[model samples]
Target: MKSGEWDRGRFVGVELQGKTLGVIGFGKIGRHVAHMGSGLGLEILAFDPFLAPHMAEELGVELVADLGDLASRCDYLTVHVPKTEGTSALIGADVLSRAREGLRVINCARGGIVDEAALLEAIESGRVAGAALDVFEEEPPTNRELVDHPAVVVTPHLGASTREAQVNVAVSAAQLVVDYLQHGKLHSPVNAVFLEPDLRERLDPYGELGRRLGCLHAQFLEGNPKRIIVKYFGDIFDEPQSRNFVTAKVLAGFLGDRCSQPVNQVNARSLARDQGLAVEEASEGRSRYFANMIRVELTDSSGERNLGGSIRGRKGIRLVSLDNYHFDAVLEGQMVISANEDRPGMIGTIGQVLSSHEMNISSMSLGRDRSGGTALSVINLDAPEIEKLAAVAEDLMQEEGILWARCLQAD
Candidate 1:
């Protein structure tokens, strides 16, 4: 109307009906998108490693096993995944290269999930048709080329900008405060453990240890958790309350930010159960070495990972054993854990990498199954940023003997 030109043919766009919509990360937002896309007569395919098959079936969405397969089959691909170590740059050149030609991309989720640079190249090469991005790797993105592309549409990351969303946020926050004040119910508690004053004095240290161990396991956890087996060793856990409280604490740590709901000691077990995870606890009268010890074993599709923690007399909390390797490592601050072959200069190589990055090592603990076998090194770094820690871990894994390196923010 403004240009005094009305050409229906020129404004014609592809019809979404009967087109396949592939949704990566089947969380709340992803599920909603799938439902809406289905209503619009679009076939839905989802790929989320953590989402159960039964759940997807109930929603009438076909769950694709692989990301590449989803990309190859879908006409439109939308991402709603969280930005994590595994998901960073998830839809990069490799995924785009394998996509169905003329695939239209949409990302209203977190930034850095789709490599913007790679997406731009794919568009230029005529592999990708277009893109609609609500988020970017950098807020107020500096990449003008991608933002100004003719086939691309960019938004200022306004996913929650609706009036209804604003109202919902305000209402939810007020309701949470009201519920907490009236009924002593905490939907989302900041602190890990919540206990009575008397119990706090006796069980605080043990609870902290359990939470730390769970957190450590979660950082490096592979696949969705199936079963969590927590073993209590020593006389300290003889009381029923002590064991129960600590078990909940362990779940609190393991499920921390992984769950959609707020996790506290009160609701951790229930939340774990809701996710189709089995919780088990065992008690032993005596520990092999320490006076008291708590071991958490998480079994997933990949394999089982076990971590043991104990509260030293003066050390507060210490990670005593990881899997079959036993050594004492302080369970606090930022840490870099690596599995490497037992060899000369391995420690020096790790140190040199950190030193090159100007990262200071606060403490180091080394454990091995045998003299000439694989070893685990837990090195504490003095307050390195998460980005730097991840880079350092990646650098460490590039070394000759290092098998894998994981960065842990224990704080």
Candidate 2:
């Protein structure tokens, strides 16, 4: 009409009301489009293999098992799924051939999901009426035939090009990077780690404790970590979804010393993958000791070591178990852990060594199954300004009963 080329009957447009609108991926954006389309009286149908049937029902959208079923029933087909190996050319010649006659297609998603060549053929053959594409297989698309096609409507991929949307995307990307860099957080990670919204809030504290355990384990172990196993026990494992966040946190802590770059939940698993290290996770109904436990085992060339912790009722995070010994101590501030034989005067000897170095002991915890057997001592220090605490740890290791000692700082 703008060019005075209007052919009243030839350029007829159809109303959207009562027409079926098929959405391929019902994630964040797809659901939004479905809601808006439904408001305009268009019947909504969708296909997402991972989507629960009840969720689709709640959205007033009928869920279809496959793309073929969606194509045969809808007047308009829209692609919103991510471009992956399985989704490249997801709607190809076969899908377009089986689609409802004169079907109009829309792709506001990533490029290459719909085969442009097939779309062109469908349009020319009158199997497809027209298409509205905001994206293309190539930017500044070189194919003039499709770009100039009278039946197709094209735009310079402007799905989120509006000023507000661009600003929002920029801010979100920057924030995710900053959060991961400074505080080891990824609000929405783009990896295998998935933490449900409801579970994240409930499991955050445990995640922190799990990371601390990983950090401690890495510091205590002598050689490079070749494999790690994170085990969840008791009520926490019952939730199932809690493990992902816990595993990511454990990895973040374990890799903290291994990487020069910032280690956080987002890149932790990826970093581990790059190093060719093996990570395994398991959950059991109960722990042999604590009701709820997060245990992390590290295996290096020398041998394997276990470090476990649990959250006590309202008292916050505790160092529940270290190797075979068990005790409850706050997991914070400067502390020293020692593996030693249980014997008289061992505690006094450790305190004497700290006093000799002018270091103050704030609190102390000792755990052992039997007297004169193996034992672990965790001594919280009040001397926060001591930079060379390792020298003092070396001094403690020289004592008669003490086997090994290491200094640690936790928060």
Candidate 3:
């Protein structure tokens, strides 16, 4: 796996919308599963007998009148209902027998949902279209029969592995329900959070911003945010000072966004509160980083997400902090800057390349390295002429025998 990659399966198609996605449990992940399903246009129907019908509607989910009906109608079935004494073989041959043909199944919630031996038989017999598993009833001693099956995609319980995913689950579970609640949007009822719409409206505009900031906090916050105090400081607050309240909301928004949950301010806070978190507020204070910063108190699930960044040149948000060190986060666009073997002017060659392409340097930052062999120069640009920029950077990295490029996608 890569820096942020986890074992979900060999990356394949994830389009889920428009299909009938039947969720067995309809719990936290199940609701999230449904939310993902809806995003891919899936018509969600959940089976959680313990929850009320109206509640399912509130989360944008439909509660099946019966489990068999859900099984019969769904094109894809994802088991979310946890394993219990009565449900040992919940997805045995009997259950699969009821499902329509070509029924794709996923079991990331827990392993016991599908009887291992039964699952293998179904897969071998072509009763299942495709299968995905993240857990096994017995962890290491997996069902070798199913493990070796190609259509039976398997992962070592990775539904809760990503740094971002774990952080969201922890924080969302800790937030105060009233501050900023989130839930399934009447499509898949799961954990429900109720909040005041006025605060929700106030918190909406900062959704993405809050999400990024919270992610930064999650990736960087040194401890578990089990008990956090969100504060709404500075000019952004109206007469209402929601320093802690808004900050907490941002954290929830961050959790909700990254996990692809149907997040809303209304439920963000409540989700935290339900998880037994101690949330507080600050009347007055100043952040050390940005002009106005929201400070978060967090505990690391593992070691901690070491993170820091700054607004670069002008509006460019560049990350400057990672782990214990701080450096300007700069990836040059076109042109050249070099950490050469300190000959006369390694910088001169880079300049020549820029001059020939008519590309101007927008901004640059250098990091400390060896006295003669290395230096890091990060440059900025005015225009992004793809061919000109890539050629220069590629040529420079190759000539220097360095791998100097990365691509990114935003959600």
Off by over 4 Å in 3: 1-15, 165-411
Better of 1 and 2 by TM-score: 1
Question: Can you write out model 1's per-residue Cα lDDT over 1-411, one digit (the tens) per residue?
Answer: 689988777666899999999999776788789889989999999887655455666778887877888999999999987676658899999999999998999999888989999999999999899999999999999878889999999999999999999999999999999998999988766564545687667678988888888888777766656788999998878877778889888887877665555666667777776555788999977986988889899887679989998987844789988889999998899998898889888889989999989999899999999988999999888888777887898899899999999988774
- Residues 1-411 of candidate 2 have per-residue lDDT tens digits of 899886788867899998999998776678889989989999999886544455566677887876887889999999877775457899899999888997999998878989999999999999889999989999989987788999889999988788999899899899889998999975655444566776666677888898889878767766445778898987866765578678888887776644435656567766676554678988866988777889888876557888888887743878888777888877888899887888888888988998898888888888987878888889899855655688888999899999989899765
lDDT of 3 by residue, 346-410 (tens): 55666665676677767666554446545545456566565465576656665442334221111
List ranges where model 2 is wrong by over 4 Å: 1-198
* Sequence-dependent TM-score of model 3: 0.39
For every model shown, what is its TM-score relative to the native structure?
0.77, 0.52, 0.39
- From the highest lDDT down, the ranking of the candidates is 1, 2, 3
Best by lDDT: 1
lDDT value for model 1: 0.85
Candidate 2 residue 65 C-alpha distance from true site, Å:
55
Better of 1 and 2 by lDDT: 1
